[model samples]
Target: MQIHRGLLQQASDKGLISAQQVQPLWDFLRECEREQAHERPGFRATHILYYLGGMIAIGAMSLFMNLGWERFGGWGLFAIALAYGVLGLALTEYLLSRRQLRIPAGITACLVVVLTPLLVYGLQLGLGWWADKGHLSYRDYHTRVDWRWLLMELATLASGAVLLWRYRLPFLVMPVAVTLWYMSMDLTPFVFQDQDQSWALRKLVSLWFGLLIVLLAFWVDVRSSRRDEQRDYAFWLYLFGVMAFWCGLSLQQSDSELSKFFYLCINLALIAVGAMLSRRVFAVFGGLGTAFYLGHLAHEVFRDSLLFPLVLTLIGLGLVGLGIVWQRHEARISARLRGWLPEAVRELVERRG
Candidate 1:
């Protein structure tokens, strides 16, 4: 779909366009491409650096926190977090309004969202409302699963929503997605109530909660597409949702070969859905799950069968062939799949940025 100046020059030489119009048309196209690049999410060098810097800062404040920070105490930590949030909001506003920078503005807005859990945790600690055992450190918010973290997750979700609404930044959805993932774990304890926590309960909760988030992500995707927004606000939601869902799905221990085959079928369906929707996240997870199932067959189910290796080798080659075939007719295949969708959903998926 790319049109270079050389192509335009060729078009001029072929009399498709006048020589005089070539440069002007090329200039217009370049400007349009530049504007589109700025408006949409891209993995270009500058965008990568923007997100990289933002992630490092966010990680430093959250995941990489040291015990030394606890010396500040609950109220002190609350004050510090408040100051950071205020400064981040100010910078976000400046980046958006004054400098017309959406990427950096989104990053700063997300940073503010990242601080919400800390803010609430600090307030809870200060008020002596934190009751979960061994939940003394704010850093435990990321590591431990406890019902006590539910309030922090709720606060984070609320603040993230408010910030996302106010700023209309796609990146602001990241913290919201992450908070939902965290809440999926914390809510397990609450659901079980006084009973000892079990992996079965956690996995089931994660599976169901992840499905809910994925549905939410789909809704957001449709809404954003309908609005003709240039940004992908549902990217993070889909990513975290798939991670949660796939992790839970993969962790289930099944001894029956039929159950394993069913797992493989589900993964195949995921791959199909991914191809239909043009979402690589689903494809990635689905591919991994498929590989896991295959590995299980090789190591356990067919260990004594020498033919299994040859069969797997043929399957791999067949998949490669399938990929080549898919690549050759991708446009036609995509169109056919899209044709089966409801008109409204088809429009949203087709118009995805």
Candidate 2:
């Protein structure tokens, strides 16, 4: 189904398109391809390299930082971070405006965002506002969950928001999503300052925060769909939101079989929602959760029960049959689903589909 210059030339040879029209058609196609490349990131080797390099750089500064670097006092760290931000912004501008390389520009913009927390950490330390512990290292920002890290997280969110607004790049949202995930944990202490902060409390906060983020992602998705925007700004939000939600939900302990079955149903609902939205992140997490519940039943509730295997096999086969039926009637089924939605929502879903 792919059309290439060779196909156009073949059409020209067949007298389908005039010789002069072939070149113009090919040029239009090429321009469309270029515009799509700018709007949507692909899994091309160069794109993979860009993401890999950006991740390595981000990890080096954040997750991989060691106490050795802490020797660079507050002002020193601030100066280094500031320098990186300035240089990164300069490079981003060059790549985006001059070279027209959006992927590299996005990566550079994300680098500046990744430095936001470090910049805030240095600022707090130098200004004496960070008086919690004399030996607190900025590295602890990732390793430990303290209310003290809230300022840095807030600063990161602000910096990411500003960058995203100015550049309108999807990759810039990655840091913002990560910061929100971190806040889901760090906010625990702030919520229960002087009380006995229980693990259950933390899990509840994470679960709610995750739901909030997912709702936010859905809103963004709807807005983008309504605008016919090709860029996916909600991808990282969905991913991190699902991670937080699923991890929190999975960590809860319950002896009641009803609760376990409820968990399975929730995951199944997630799969259905994923199908509705055309989002793989939801389906992936939902699949993992479903597998976990099934594993639990097989190992614990139905160990050595011959009926369990038979039932599971029947269910699997039924799913395969259902998949076949769905494949045969996917268009009709999708249309029916859209018909069940309101007009505005249907339009959004159709556009996304």
Candidate 3:
């Protein structure tokens, strides 16, 4: 314990960390070790074996079905199955390797290498399908509901959800789940057989779900904060899910005024929530909300008028001026407020500056 204390002191002296932050850093280190133990190769191997056995059992069952053995002899089907097995094994191994399970890094790479192209291809296919069906307008595409397509979509979403659960990959799962929900919207009309009712119901459900996710995320953040720990990036997953849910809600409402109002309310709520969380990113989001409000007012004044450019230019200048003034006056603001603030608050402000 003395040696540990000395090492911590040395670390603090080197500016590797502050004395106050050492406790949380030590706790995080212990947590990582615990997680690493769970992700050992032996445990991973057992998990892989179990999944492989299940896959084989399913494949064998499929082979016994009415679809003749000859049909399964095709190279494409065989290759696909082989690839699936190989990829599953690779993914399992990667997850089980303690040092390799860098959640943020892994997810960012996966999004770039996998999700981005997948989404692009899916969008192209969806567009082509719509075009072939003579649905030129976006609204027309929503009206045309195909049950078979919707079932396929649901199946795809289920498969993704299962994969996420099995691998315990929250980062990948969150985005995939959100994309699944978005794709699910295309199926809404088929379920209700009317765009208006279907979309309205979808929006209401989405709003509820969004609020739930956001609140859950905040709870998670607060829990972590209380422990003086870093929050997981998966918290952003909850945010994305909430955002996607709201996007669906926005699409459902055709009334431009109502949509704008709803969007403003949501942004304002985000700002409030972010402030409470003491998140810099969320504070930036709040700033964005303010900007959006300003833009909306400007839009109303300049709508279909020659004053549009002038209004935009004035807004831009005003924002730049405010930024400069803030930067210049920041020290004065800090000094003046320091005497009235608590010690903790003063320290926080000074550190931020």
Where does candidate 3 clash, by residue pair?
none
| Candidate 2: worst-modelled 10 consecutive residues by lDDT | 188-197
Clashing pairs in 2: none
The top-ranked prediction according to lDDT is: 2
Error of 1 at 9 (Å): 4.4
Candidate with more favorable, higher lDDT: 1 or 2: 2
Q: Write down the worst ten-residue block by lDDT for model 1.
A: 128-137
Over all chains combined, what TM-score does candidate 1 have?
Answer: 0.90
lDDT of 3: 0.51
TM-scores for candidates 1 onward, in order: 0.90, 0.90, 0.45
Candidate 3 clash total?
0
Residue-level lDDT of model 1, residues 1-353, one tens digit each, is: 57899999999899999999998999999999998898676889989899899999999889999889988878888999999999999999999999989999999989998998889877887887765546358888898877778888888989998998898988899899988888878887787783588879888888878878889988888888778567888899999998888888888888889998999998898887786677999999999999999889888888799899899889889999999999999889878978888897898767652
Clashes of 1: 0
lDDT of each: 0.86, 0.88, 0.51
For residue 274, give model 2's deviation from the true position in Å.
1.0
Residue 295 in model 1: shift from native, Å? 1.5
